[model samples]
Structures are given as structure tokens and as C-alpha cells.
Target: MINRAEGAYLGAVRAFQNPMLDLLHKRHAPLVVSVLSACFTAERPNVSVADAHTQIGDALDQLRAAGYDESLPIGTSRDLCRQWADAGWLMRQVVDDVEVYRLSAHAVDALDVAGRAGGARARVSQSRVRTMLDAVERLAQDADPDALVRMARLDAEIRRLQQELDRIQRTGAVEEVDDEQLLEEAENLLHLARELPADFARVAESIKSMQRDVVTALRQDERPTGEVLREYLERAQHVMEATSEGRAFAGALRLIGDPQRLDGLSNQLDVVLRHRFTGRLAPQQRTELREIGHRIEQGLDLVFTTQREASYVITAQVRNHDPLRDRQVDDLLRDVMTGLQTWMPESRRGQSVDPLRRLPVAEVDHLRQTAGDLRPAQPPAPLEDRDDAVVDVTSDEARAWGGPHYAELDRHLVTLADGRSIVDVAVAFNAAPEALRRPVDLLGLLELADNQGMEETDELAFVDAVRPDGTRRRLAFGGVTTRMKEAVDE
Candidate 1:
């Protein structure tokens, strides 16, 4: 007794409320989609929470630099990620005991939509029509309850194939699909493949939901254990069959599960990439075609891993179901909630409680005792006098290993600056003793020049300095000129 038009209008409203549609229709849809596409890919579908913050923070900086300030969401990367998780565009879960952020099914769907929108439009071609025809025919043949109709359809298909084979054998020539048709079919296949990630994500999400339901049911203890166990068994067996998306994924898995089929797909993709017609395709398109098989494999692996983890968690919970413990924990939580409710009004009026940064230390009554000795068993021997050891005070090699003689250099510079208003640092450096002519000494001279407010000139100058190992080398640096003290006073 409902009007079809009103029902359709209400349905559209509900559909728009879906996370995927919300993502697509949001004001910052472009920003959200672009950021997600850059962050998550087939190669890296999940990012640790910390890494997500850093990468997205850097991405926002780049966007702002590229003039997207007005379009960017407010708050830090952590805030934005939390918001996205709350909005159902991102899934925040623990993977390998580490918190990570993964693109939700809704987010993946939005990305697929964005990717297709940015790519070349799918044209209405013979390849598309043929694909539709083939799908419809196969579906009819499979769905036909009458055996005669099915047999007749198969007979016609067999005869047509036989005719083509006979003609090919007679002419020794095979019909080649043109470049246009091949490209069309390749694009169509890629278009279908693009949805695999979203589909796989949905399946994983559904399994997680089932896990939550099973755990809740187990904890509630409202039903008998036998009934709950039976329901769980049935759900576990049909986890992949529980939803339409999961069923489609199961079918895909069956098709791709064969190693031989995957290998054949890889070989075909390689051959296609080598074809001259593929040159017309964009680089992204070509790369996607090459990776289609691997992408499907990764998606399947993710889903399987998710299923196993969910099953393990649920099974463990079932085995460890403690109704009394669960009830006690629920009571404690409710008590806490009641206290919070009582305190919230007071808090709103500025009565606040200091939040603990960490758990307090526990108090203990007694401590363990330990005894140690700082004194040695026997007294250590006194230091020996080495004044009788030979010494080489005048060895140039000894001085070479020591630091620069700053006092000697200062006196020498004063002597050089005596009637000259300006002194060139390189000339003074070259005239100094070998000990003062070490590279360290050259650096010392530059520091002195710099401290005297002498700016380096653009002209290049070279200084010959000896290394600690007795090797001499020439080094080039900017010309530095320092004025004498007398000149500065004048």
C-alpha cells in the first residue's frame, strides 16, 4: 500500500546516508580521495597509526603548499584520521598487536570511483556489447530449468564454435581482434578488477561484525551454550556465504584459486603489455594491467587472514566463556558509567578532576636486602713514577699531533699586521710554521678572521697546509681579508 515514488525517494535518501556516498558527496571529497589514494595502495593497504599521522601530516603540508589551504580539514593529522574513522571512511584496528589504519570499504569504493572518474571514459564498444551478450547467455543457460532448452543452447554454442574451427582449419588463418577492441576489453577488465579491493574489504568487515555478534552473544549468556555453539558453527561455515559481496568474492576466489589460472593470467598480461596497441594506454593503465593478478592475490590473502583471525578470536572466546566473570566486569563498567554520569554535570560547571598520565605505583611493606663491598679484598698498588721514561720535547712530529698554537699564531699575525692596513688570511697562512700550517690551524685563522668581522670575498684563494700525517695539500676557499686593529680604530 506504499506509493512507489515516495518509496524510491526515501530509498535514495537512505542511500545517500551510506558512508561511501557521504564520502563522494562531501565538500572535501576531492581532498579526502586524493589523500587516501596517495597514502594507501595495493602494495601497502594498512599503515600503522603513528606512520599514518606522519604521512598524512606531510601530505597535508604538501597540499597546503600547493594552494589547498581553504579546502583542507581543520586540526592535526591525528584528528583528521580519528574523524575519518568515526565517519566510517577509515578502519582503525589492531594488526599484529599494533594499531593501524586501513581504508574502509567505503573509502576504497570512493577511491575506485575517483580513479575511474580521472581515467579515460569507458566508451560504448563492440567489446562491451559482446561481454554483456556472453554473460546473459551463460546466465540463461545456467538458470533454465528445462533440460531441453539448456541442451539446445549448448548445441548451438558447440556448432558455432565448430564452424569457426572448421573455417580456421580450412583457411589456416585465425581472426585477430583489432587494437580498438583489445583496448576496450582490457579497460573493461581493469574496470572490474578495480572493485576487488572494496569487495574484499567488505568481506573482511562482515566477518569482523560476525565476530562481534558472536562474542556479544557469548558474553550475554542469555541463550544456552549449546544453542550459541550451534549458531556459531553455522555462521562460521557460511561466513563467506552470509552476504552477497562475500558470495561474489567466494566466486572470484574459486576462479583465481587455481595456480594454473593465475599463471596463465600473468602470461597473458605480459603478452598484452608487449603488444604495440598497448602503447596507446596510459602508464597507469599499463602498470595496472601488469599487476592485476598480484592485486587479486593480495586481496584474497587479506580476506583469508582476516577470516582466520576472526575465527580464532571467536573460538578462543567460546572456549573461555565465563558468564560470572563477564557479569562482574559489566557491573564494574556500569558503576563507572553511573559515577561519570553523576560527575558530568559538576564537570560542566568547571569542577574538574586531574587526569592520571600513568598508573600509580603500588605500595609495598617490605623490601629485599642485599650486601655488597666497595673495598677490594687486597689493597691496590700505588702508582709508579714514569719520570725516568725518555721524552722528546722538541720533536716536530710530536707537535703535529697536538692542537694549533693559538698564542703563537696570534703573535705572528700581530707582527704581520704591523704596517699593513689589511692582511690576506691565505698569505699569512702560507707563511706560518708547519705546525701552525696544519689544516686545523687554517680553520683557526678563518675563525679569528670571522670573529674580527671580516667578510669573505667572492674571489677564490688557495692555501697549502700539511696534514697530521705529514702530507701537504692545496685547498681553495673564499678570500678573507681582516683589517688591522689600528685601521679599525682609525
Candidate 2:
């Protein structure tokens, strides 16, 4: 018999090596691969047959224009889709009288691999080293039970860490990285993030497969209910506890659900994107990151929902086949009585009288008094005050209040010229009419930064201004610049 490890390996290989993949590798099947990629690139769960045909048509047109003279009619594209479905690379379903096609789990894996093979190179980061070290430590701890030995190893690790820190402090060294390198690292992080969702999709498929197996077993098996239930539980337990994928997925689920970790990751990415070494992300890149984040969250949700659905199915099946539920309480009680009678002697099977009935009434009263005396005393109740007091309900005298300070900042920013330091502009604004003589504080300047006309830059400036009270305040402000008129004209 093939062992479970061998079976799993073979199953994975079979999943990836579908006939459609083989066909796509053929010399004349380049267009087929392109069509599949175009259809699946949207990361959607499914596409309608008509939509797929249109996409394939576009792909074929592009291919034909590139010096390929193969005929690719809509009908041929449909036939190829059917072949893919037959090869288990796609699943076809009828929805609302229209046929739709979805990439199977295997197809998704294959496409992901193909895309990555042609994509940019991966970059290694500090997190990789930390993860590796953590994994190695965990393995060591699992392999060795001796606390002293572990402590010795930990001491050595601490010394090495201290030595590294000392070296850094002594050298006062800094590592400089180029913008291109940082951008590459950011791309790598995003690539890793995308893979997390794909892994979740695979796990969700596995869970669905497990659900189907359980249903089939429950429906087809003729064994005793307890025996069948035991088998099912064993299988479920093995999947959850013994499998590597299950453990890794469970860990990922926990990490994703942690609010602190998610916040940390978000902050880290924002810092990287906004850092002086990296610069701001393009609008399209930001959108892509948001989409990937959403997909990851959705994938995690899918895993949870799939598991819940599987649990519900198992529960329903178990209830339907439950032997305990089939036996009434009365029947169970009768059986117990029959067993008791079978074990007892015929003379000793008479109805027994209550022993307490034979006790004297005076003794019962004495016992009740003793039990009452033995009970613990209750604590005293809290005191309640009955005093009342009157209070004034009049509003305070109205005082002159300035409107939102930021509104003045916005008006001042719009009136200023572009490419001027923030301090020079602030000084000019203060000298202008309707400008606040109190001078805009840092908080007010930050509020200006949020205005459509103002943006923070690396430029800096200082200006001295006087308050309405004639006190001189030296202000340092100027990272903001403006191009409001240019934007509006555009």
C-alpha cells in the first residue's frame, strides 16, 4: 500500500500536471496559454462563457498580428475551453441559463506559477532572516527537551546579539540603499502578500474536498453510526493536526486576525512608501496594494466561511444518522429497568420504602434547626442617602469665537504663489489683510497641508512674526508648496 506521504505528493503532482498544462506547452499552443492567462488575470472567481470568448478573441487577434497565422475562430476558442473543462483545468456551470467558466484550483496554481516565472526577480529582506531564525529555534526546541542545553544555546545567542550591537555602536556605520532597490523590495513584499491569498484559496479548496468526502462517506457507508462517526472525526483531526498545510494555514489565519499585527504591517508599508529613500507610490501601485489587501482579507474570510459550511454539513448528516436520537427517553429508562431486574434476585425486587419516612418527627425538627444554625451569616446592607441639592442651569455669557482656524489657512494658501517656501508664504499671508496676527502654529500648518492646494515637501524656511499683542515669535515653517492654479487650469 502507498503511504499517506507518498499519496499526498502524488496528488499534488497530479493537480499541477493537468492535460491543459501539457497542451499549453506544445509549440503551436502559445495562443492557448495567452488566452487562458487573459481570462484568468482578473483574479475573479469565474467568468461568463461570452466574456471568455471575447477575451480569447482579443488575445487571438494580438497573437495573429504578431506574425502567427493560426486560425482562431470563436468556435475554436469555445472548443478549447471545453477541452480545458474536460481536463479539469476549468469548471463550467450554468447560471441563470448562461454558462460560466471558472479556473479550477489546479489551474489557479498553474497560472500563478507561470506568471511568477515571467515576473521580476524576488528580493530578500530582514524579515526573511528573522523568520528563518525563528523556524530553526522552534525546531530545536521541539527536538531537544533538556532545559539546561537550551539555556546554554540561548546564552550564546544573546552574546552574539550583544557583540553585533557593540560592533554597530562602535563603527557608527550606516547602510545606504538606492531608490530602485527599495522599490524592488516593496514589490517583493507585495508579491509575497499576493501569494498569501492564493494559499488561502488552495486551503479553501482542500476544505471543500474534505466536505465532499465526508458527505459521500456518510451517504454510502453501511457501518454502525458510532463507527462511522469515529472515522470521520479521526480524518478531520488528522487534517487539522497532522498536515503541514493545515498548521501553516492555521498560523496564517491567527496572524491575519491579529489587529496589532495588521496595523503594524500597514504602518510599515506606509513608512516604506513615504520614506525619503523610496518616495511616494504611484496611484496605480497604491490601488494594486489596496486590491491585494482586500483579496487577502476576502480569502481569509473564505476559509472561515468554508469551514463553517463544512461543519454545518457534517452536523446535519450526523443528526440524520444519530442512533441516540432514535431511542426515546422512556425506552432508555425501560431498558435500564430491565437490566436492573435481570441482575437482581426475585425476592429482592419488591418496591422499596423511603428510609426517611421511618425517622421520628422530633429528630427531623432538630436536624433542621442544626442546619439553619450552620448556615453562614449574611453581610449588612449598604446605607442609602436621601439628601437632595439644587444646581444652576444657566448658560455662560457668550464670548467672541473665531471660525475654524484651518479655513483661514486655506484661504491664505489659495492666494499665495506656487514654489514659495511655506515660511515666506506664511509671512506674506500674515502681512496681507484678514490674516491672523497670532501667527499659524504647527497644528494649523498641518491642517493647511491637508488642503488641496498645499503639500509638504523637503524644503524648509524660517520667519519671525509678531502677535496681535506685539510679542515677537520666531516661527520655523516651510515644508509646504502649492500649485493650485495650475491644477485648476488643467
Candidate 3:
């Protein structure tokens, strides 16, 4: 319908050649279109031609060709001429006793534009029809002789599409066009299968798979590679299950043991998988694809649960590194990430996770982004400010302690450089394997007043505790080791 409307408008917009003009001469369209066309061109006045021609212009000849005899039905050529004059498509005048009907500039301009665009639209429409017909020809060659009927059907479809294009051109718009080329392409391939000998049919079955695949590939927006495989396998199985007794590719798959062909298809699959998966799949998900346990057990035959008859023999041949296969792994990773979000406790984890430390970059970024604790606090500004103060020092503790937290008696355990126990150094250190027994010993303190060696400090400078929080707090580290000995001797 849209195409029809467009075609109608397109015809109205352009000027017609002799044949087309003949078609439109007495039609109702010329009255309106002639005026609109006039609005588009420069005017020419006082132009005269010889009376031996016995006519005004080519437009008059068109009406005459359309049987402008006095015997016509509703109105004869005279009556129609009067109508055109009234409608402003033409003007009547006399000079030297010769009548000349001149085209209005409006009519001329509309005709010129309409003619250009209309011709262009016609050309494009013809091209599309040709393309569709080419596909039909291929289908005819491959399908059963009886399937020739399908070619005719496709031709009809092309004709319909051509008409539609014409209509759209007229209207200057095309919307909701269901013109997926693959749909017909698949049918064309299928036709070849139907016409081929059994030996060829075997290969044809595999090719027909292309048709089915096109339907899926375009429809799925975010479909994972593995899921696609799974879909293909299931589809094959369903088709096989629906019809029985024939051992074919769609039915038996054993016919596809041709090594070269298998390699080619497998390579294609590899390309698809590489594009879709890559490192995109996470470790856990990757692990899942490697697991043969989840798949139905088969000896020697490897099945891509997705592709029908899409299986291979487990020889020394290399495994297919299809990005698509990795999609399963990728999806599983997303699921794990989302699941951990709700239940997992905060710790150090990341692309480089120290299971012992539990710090993840994503989690860290989340903390940085989130507003500090909004809950009521002892001081009222929200205790979340304090949350930033606490560090998961175990992350640094590993540099300090060398291994997972060990009990103090284990002998290697040591305290922080401060008096605080190693266990107390980290935010969750209390819950860590509690193994610390003592704080680190302290040495005497001195100030480097300038670039000189150093400046001696008063005994008071080396206090048992120095305030880290700005306010005075008696947080101690260790007793003076050598300073006390010197002082005692003094």
C-alpha cells in the first residue's frame, strides 16, 4: 500500500514522455499534477510555432493518441481540453489567427522534476527485481524439478516488491520494510538440496543449515556463542526427531564425515567463536566449557550441542578455538559476578585476587564511588568517613608476613612496625588467622634538621606513643632498646 501511494505521487510529480502522457492525457491526475509542475519552472510567453504542425504541443498529441474522438464516453477531447485550461495546466491564446496552447511554468517544472525522480525510481525497482530473479534461478537449478514452482513464487514476490518500491518512490517514504535478503537466500540454497542426487543432498543438508542459521543470527541481540551452539544442536535434534528413518545430515549427520568439508565448517565456527568470546569469557566459565562431564558422553564423536550433525571425530586433530564456544564461559562469568554481588563479603579480590587477602578492583571502585556510610554515627557526620580510615592491611601484610597468617608460636609471626599486633594492622585482621604475639621494638628518634647528618633529639622527642590521629592518644609501640641503657649509665 505504501509503495502504491508513493508510485502514484511520483507519477504526479514528474513529466511524462509521449507514451506516458498518452496514458495520463484524459486521466484525472493531469489537472492537479499539471498545475503543481507549473509551480516549478520559468515562464515562457509570446513564443509561437508554425501552423503547419496543426497542434499546440506534444501534450495535445497525447490526448489525440488516447482516442480523443468525439465518440468518447464521459467527455470528449474538447471537454477535457476545457478542463485542463480551467485547471491551469494549460492556457489558451491566439496570435495571427493561429491557436497556441502554452504549458504553464508550474506544469513544466513539476514535469521535469517528476520525470527525473520517477525515472530513477523505475531503474532501481528494475534492479531489485533482477536481483530477486537471479536468486530464483539458482533455486531452480538446485531444487527438485517440481520445486520450479518455488521460482515462480519468488518471481511473484519480486514483482510485488517492485510494485512496492514504485509506490514508495511516489510517496517519498519507506517504512517497516520486511526485506531480509537472507530469508530468500536460505530458500534458494534449500532448493539446490531438493534437486540434487543423494550424494549431493548430503552436502546440501549442511548448506540448508545456513538458512536456519541466518534466522537465528539476526534475531538474537545478545545471544551468547555457546547458547547459539546449544540452539543449533537442539534444532538439529528436533528436526531429526520429527522425521525418522532417513540417515542424513539433518537426520543422521554421519554423512558429513568428509574431512575437508568438516575442517572448512569448523574453521567458520572458529571465526564466529573468536569474534563472540575471546577473553570475554571468565575463568570459571572457561572451566565449564572444558568440562566434558556436563555434555552427553560419546566416544570418538565430538558434538557441538548447538549445530545439528555438527560434530567431529576426536582424533589427534587440534581442538576448535571458536570464540563462540567461549560464550558459554563468558555468560557463566557474568552470572557468577552478579551472584557474588549480593552475598559475598567485602575483601580483597580483583583481576589479581589474593584469596588470602580478598581485594577486587571492581569492589574497590564501588567503595570509592559510593557515598560514605549514611547511617547515624556517634559524631553525626556519618561514621562512613571512618570506613575509609581502615585499611585491609593484610594486603600489605603479605609483604610484611610473607605467607597466610600463621599462629604466633609458629615462630615467624611478627608485629607491625607500630606496637599494634600484626592481626590488628588490617581492617579484618581480627578475623584473620590470629597469630601475632608482640609489637615491633622501637629505636631512639632523631630529627634531620637540615641536609646535615642529623640533629640530636631530646629524650622527650622519643615518647612511648605519638598521636597518628592529630589528637593525643597513648598508642604505644615498644620500650626504648639502647636509649635506656645509655641513660641508665649516665
Candidate 4:
């Protein structure tokens, strides 16, 4: 409702409550609406009260044409009649059985205050006899008495709310309400949150605990080496994602109270899902860790890398293929048996660790006897004890000592490659026939390095292991560097 002037509003209410106004509405309201709508829409000069319904319809049509599409659900005639009557702003009459509508006195009273010329009420005087005329003629009232009654009820509601508006305007401070005070309820909620139940408090404690654990894990240098460090980093990354999820849950708690569904299972589940480091380890993972740790503890020197000047920063657990694993196990077993060879002579073969260092006394004596033992061959040659590690035999020696198979090896027709090129063939050689080509790749050269360890020996032998003829490429001793402090045997 538009804010009507104070006088107009009070007058409308007075008119509405007045019993006379009720009679007045019963008489003229519809006719007045029809005429007013007609005149407001009256683009033309002549309009009859008898033509009020048509005029009202024309006005509604004009409104439609003007793009004001307010829905007039029922016929304009009856709706206009009902609205004007309800407002007590018009009057109705039947002249010659033809319904005509015009304005009423009370409507004039209110509209005069609303700045209307004469609300809807008007009267005509003819010479001597004067008569009252009003705008109440446009009713087809017999059509639906119930509809009119309903509109009357709605009109009463309108009057009631209008009066309520008037009362508010008179003294209520509702319009200028303060926003800060409005947020008082939320502040009360915050106070309640401070006094949280035991459940939420427990959750907060657990979150703090988790924060401490992950933070501590990040702070510590628990990973002793690169591989171990990488594994630790992987675990950290996994748990960090878990922490992100936990944080999400924490945020979600702000929306939905403490999570009750998983609350009981939270602590243990968090350890498994959120903690990065496990205090305990499985037997096998523990064994691997210990072995790798020992390898580290042996000094970073044990890791021999291919790039001579490059540091062995990366320790790849050699790809665990079955053939490789089997070979490693067999080598280990062979080493064990070799170490106990003298006691367990059932071992057909006895391997040497550095033949130059661990010389056989008997072989030393024999070499002494051969040269009258003069100077006693102080660095006695490996007369009998030699490793199957470094086989260094030239063509003539290969023929004389290695026999017919020696020539076959030169062309690779015979694949007796392991340690073949490094060790003197007369002292040591591989007897395995590569009939199926399995030993092709891992055939390390038999390097005769002056160094005392197999790692250096292997590294040196590996660097300079080859027969110039390229027959056994496995003896990759094609390297050409001079004998340095730790020079590999060529």
C-alpha cells in the first residue's frame, strides 16, 4: 500500500468502520471504480455512467497495451465493482434496470485529503430540485454474492493492516533497528561453543596431538641415507595428504558439530591413516633396513658407482629379478662353502679372496724350490692359489694353458666369460658353458688389480676388461687409463 497522507488514511479507516460507510459502500463503490478507471483511461471526452463497465474494460486494455501486465484474473467489470465497493470509494445504482456506477460522499471525503478533486462522490442540481449522484452504478451484483463477501473480508484485512501501519508510524522505533544488537544471538552461540562438551574437547586434543606428531616427524633426521630418506619422504607425503583430510574434517566440524560417527574410532584410525612413521616394523622390511643400514655404516665408500668421479648418491636396490636373486644366493652359498673348504673337503672347489694377499705356503715353498728359493720369491707368484676372478691370458698363453677352448672363447663360440679376461687363464677361469646365453650380461672381467678388495678389483677389472679382438665383450676391460693409486687391472 502506498503511504497515504495521514488524513486520507485515518479518513479511510473511519469510513470503513462507519456503519453509514458500509451502507454507502453497498450502494456506490463499484460504480466509482468504474468511472475513475474510465476517466483515468479516458483519452476521449464523452463517457456515460451506463458505459462504466466498458470504460473500465477499455482502461484495463489500455494498461495491457501500455505493457503493464498486472493480471486481472476475473472479468474487469466485477473486479472493479468489488475493489471500489470494498474500498467504500464508489456507489452503484440501477437506472431503467441498467447498472450505472459513480462516486460516493465518503470516497470524496478521503480523496479530497488524497488531493483528488472529489474522491468518487458527486452530486447534480437541476434548477430547483437538487439530487445526489454518485459513482455506484456498475454492479452485476446478482452474479456472485459469495465473491463480493470474500472481497469484503479482504477489504477488512486491508483496513486492519493499514491501521497497524498508522500505529507503527505514530511511535514505534522498529525502522531504525541496530545491526550489532541483532547479532547478539550469534555471540550467545559463541559463548556456548566455549563451554563445549567433552567430545569436542577430546577431538581438539587429538588434532593437537596429531599436529605434534607430524611436526616432530618432519623435524627429525630419521632417514639415515638416500633410499631410507626417500622412503621416509614417501611416507611423509602420504600422511600429509591424510593431514589435509583431517584438516578438512576439522573445518567440517565447524559446520556440523563434533563428528559423532567416527569419533570413537578416531584415535587409532588416525594413527594408522595419519601417522607417517611406524614405531614397529615387519621382520622382512626390518631386515632390508638393517642390511641397507650396514651397507651405509660400512662407510659411503662401499657403494661403487659406474661414473668414477661421481658420488654414489643414489642406491637403487638392484631390480630384483629371479635370475639375479638366484645368482646372488648361489654366490653367497659358494662363498660360505669356500670359506670352510679346508675343513669340509667335500667342497670340490676352493675360491681365493685376493690370491696376491692370501698366498698358499706350499705354493710359495714350491716356487722357492724351483728358483733355489733365493730371495724366496718374496712376492711369490700365485704358483697354485689363484682366484677364478682375473683371467689374463694373451693368445699364445691362452693356447698353451687354456687349450683348444681358448680359441673358441676368442670368437665367443665358447662363452666362458666370467672373470676370464682379468685373471690369468692358467690360474683361474669359468667352466660354465653359456649354451643358453644366460650368462651374457653379468660376465664381469677377471681384473688383476693390486688393490686388496673384490669391490676395487671388480671396479678396476670392470673398467679395463677386454681381449683386443672383441671376442668376449663381457670382459669389458677396454679402458685405457694408467695404473693410478687405485687403478683397475687391464
**Quick one: best TM-score, which candidate?**
1
Q: Go through the candidates in order and give the clash count of each.
A: 0, 0, 38, 40
lDDT of 3: 0.40
The global Cα lDDT (0 to 1) of model 1 is 0.86
Best by lDDT: 1
lDDT of 3 by residue, 1-490 (tens): 5698899878766745432353345445544354324332222222333321233334445655787634333443455556656755554555446665554333443454454454422232433565679879787667756666777777999999999999999998866423344333323333223222222222323434543563445234356556655665566556544432223333324424456765665575354335433345445333323322211122112222223323431111114444464567668898989877955676553435435566555634333655588975565465455766786756854434343223332222122222222221211222223232112211112110111122223322212222222332233322211112222234
How high is each candidate's TM-score?
0.68, 0.49, 0.15, 0.17
What value does the lDDT take at residue 301 in candidate 2? Answer: 76
**Where is model 3 poorest over a 10-residue stretch in terms of lDDT?**
441-450
**How big is the RMSD of model 1?**
13.7
**Decoy 1 TM-score against native:** 0.68
lDDT of 4 by residue, 1-490 (tens): 6556987988889867863355435544343434463453212212345476576777667766887555433456657656766664554534344555544434433322332233322222231121112112123334446887768867998999998899899988456424343233223322222222222222322333443443333334344334444554454334323543334334443433445533533453343333233224334333333232222222122111111111111212222224456567768898878777755664334454444666455634333336455464457567676588666676654533332343343333123334343333211233334321222222321222222223223332332222424445344443221122222354
RMSD for each of the candidates: 13.7, 28.4, 31.6, 42.5
- Model 2 RMSD in Å is 28.4
Q: What digit string (tens of lDDT, one per residue) describes model 1 on residues 320-381? A: 88999989999999999999999887676456688879987989898866448776577779
**Residue-wise lDDT of candidate 2 within 110-184, one digit each (tens)?**
666666666654546555555568789899888999999999988999999998789889998856777766666
Each candidate: what lDDT? Answer: 0.86, 0.63, 0.40, 0.39
Query: Which ten-residue region of model 2 has the weakest summed lDDT?
Result: 395-404
lDDT of 3 at 65: 79
